[model samples]
Target: EADIYQTPRYLVIGTGKKITLECSQTMGHDKMYWYQQDPGMELHLIHYSYGVNSTEKGDLSSESTVSRIRTEHFPLTLESARPSHTSQYLCASTGLAQETQYFGPGTRLLVL
Candidate 1:
């Protein structure tokens, strides 16, 4: 697994707060993805990118946004967070072997 890390592993904030969950990978993988998961629930893909400047929404529709400005950085942002946005955001990256994914410690967001 690639060395991936997520910032602010746990967060609690009032509603309507602007939030940015940072994800950085040291393996320099080209394929990165963001997923959302509620407690004890299945994960849902929210965004992905094949490489820098190549971003696309994932299978699940999301109110948040993501950017791939650099190969090592992929951050998800909510312009205005809400209670409904409370969930764990996972960051994953796949190397040449696309089937294998290395995941970071997820950022658990709890918007009041």
Candidate 2:
């Protein structure tokens, strides 16, 4: 079981709709990340934050944006949804004392 949580475990939206994926951790982790993936494909890191007020875009280019204003919450938002944006979003957080990361149940999105 993981302490991290993700809202709207599954999402279906039309093109041009705005959507936000919420992620939160109960473990008080300072490091959090968002990954984009397709079924049967490798995960791509899309965004990350070291702590509050610190965020960086990841290796993959993503139209979505993320914010880390509080220590336990990190949310990803897309201003306008598109069919090309369909993918699974995974949220993870790592404890300061451990290298292991706790992952939330991924949000599966489909934009039609």
Task: List model 1 lDDT by residue over 14-112, tens digit each.
Answer: 998999999999997999999999999999999999999999999999999999999999999999999999999999999867688999999999999
How far residue 24's Cα lies from its native spot in candidate 2, in Å, is 0.4
User: Between which residue pairs do clashes occur in model 1?
Assistant: none
List ranges where model 1 is wrong by over 4 Å: none
In model 2, what lDDT does residue 31 have?
Answer: 95
TM-score of 1: 0.96
- Model 2 regions more than 4 Å off: none
Displacement of residue 76 (Cα, Å) in model 1 is 0.3
Each candidate structure's TM-score, on Cα atoms with residue i matched to residue i, is 0.96, 0.97
Clashing pairs in 2: none
The C-alpha lDDT values of all candidates are: 0.94, 0.96
